[model samples]
Target: MSNLSDIIEGFIKELLEANSQRAIEIQRNILAQQFDCSPSQINYVLTTRFGNDKGYMVESRRGGGGYIRILKVSTSIEEELKNFLNESIGDSVTLNKALDLISALRERKIITDREQRIMQSILGDRALKGVVYEDRNKIRADVLKEMILASAENDM
Candidate 1:
């Protein structure tokens, strides 16, 4: 059986797909109860799976009648690449965040299969072992930014 987080994520995605509007509203506590998991698990799946880079936005209202609204937003490849450029810090990226960007690029089909593998390999923490977190983050940022630019050049 799939883990609760994956199950919950799939269920929510199914709901979004079935809806004509491509959005869904659900009560977090109710979802947790339905899945027999803690509310934090729902939060984990939403943050890691339905993230902004994955083309989903999450909104929440707290208190008695609180609800979580998930909206699917569309973005062009160019715009997404530009967003990555804008968000990069000096030259380093934490390993997890670099992997997130690589996954996003792959999800958008902005990078080829080979490119994805190359990026994943080079961005691995093991590849940058012994480098401090701050330095790794900046270097990852620089390399990813360059890769994005190279992709753009190929498009022209």
Candidate 2:
């Protein structure tokens, strides 16, 4: 069975899908009531699953009129790639973050399944095991950025 966090993430993704604009405003309390979970649980799912690194931006207003707004940040392949390179990847990225970024690329059909697997293999922790702990993330970021650029070049 899926965990509560997974379930809530799915529900929110469904709502986002139903909206033509690919964005949604939701009430934390109402969603918490519906899920029978605390508002903090909802916040956990939103931050971990829908964060900027995962290609979504979350904004929340706290109060009686407060609401949470989730926005799908990328509109086009170019824009998405740019965001990943210029913003998401940054100077250093953990292996998990790199994998998530690769997953986002695959989700958008920016890369094929085979390509995704290949990229994952290249960026996986095992591949970087020999590197110094402090330098691994930095090297990973540089490599992934180049790979993304190469893929974009091929598409052109």
Candidate 3:
């Protein structure tokens, strides 16, 4: 059986595909009624799946007219590449943090599976193992940034 989060994500994806510009107005009462789940469950899905790092912006209005609005942030391939390059610069990203950032990009459909795999390989601890780990990491970051920037430029 699929989990509630997966189901909700699929539903939201379908809705987005059908109308890319449309903002979903989720009401706890209405979603709970449809899914036969608690209102809090609805909240959980929104909080976890519709986060900014995942390229979604969520807003809610309270009271009788209370509704949740989820807006998908659409960025060009160039924009995403640029952002990734900018972030990777001048920083020593830990393995866990790097994974998290990659996961977020994957969730937003900005990076392909192959790209992610390559990125992992390049950023893996094994690749940076040595007395010069810090230097290796900095070099890796620079290389990754250059790759992204080059890809972005190609897309233009």
Clashes of each: 8, 0, 0
What are the per-residue Cα lDDT tens digits for candidate 3 across 1-156? 999888987887777677757567777778778888888888898887777656678998878879888888777876756665565444556666566666776666656788778777877778777638657656666656665555346457
Question: What CA RMSD would candidate 2 show?
Answer: 1.6
How well is each residue in 41-118 modelled by candidate 1, as lDDT tens digits?
A: 989999888877677889999898999999987666677667656763335667777777777778767788888888
Poorly placed runs, candidate 2 (over 4 Å): none
Q: Rate the local accuracy (lDDT) of all candidates.
A: 0.81, 0.89, 0.71
Q: Which is the leading candidate under TM-score?
A: 2
Q: What would the TM-scores of all predictions be? A: 0.81, 0.90, 0.69
* Model 1 misplacement above 4 A: 88-91, 125-134, 152-156
Please give, for residues 12-93, the per-residue lDDT of candidate 2 as tens digits: 9999989999899999999999999999999999989998767788999999999999998766777777877988899998
Question: Cα deviation of 128 in candidate 2 (Å)?
Answer: 2.9
On TM-score, the stronger of 2 and 3 is 2
Worst 10 residues of 1 by lDDT: 83-92
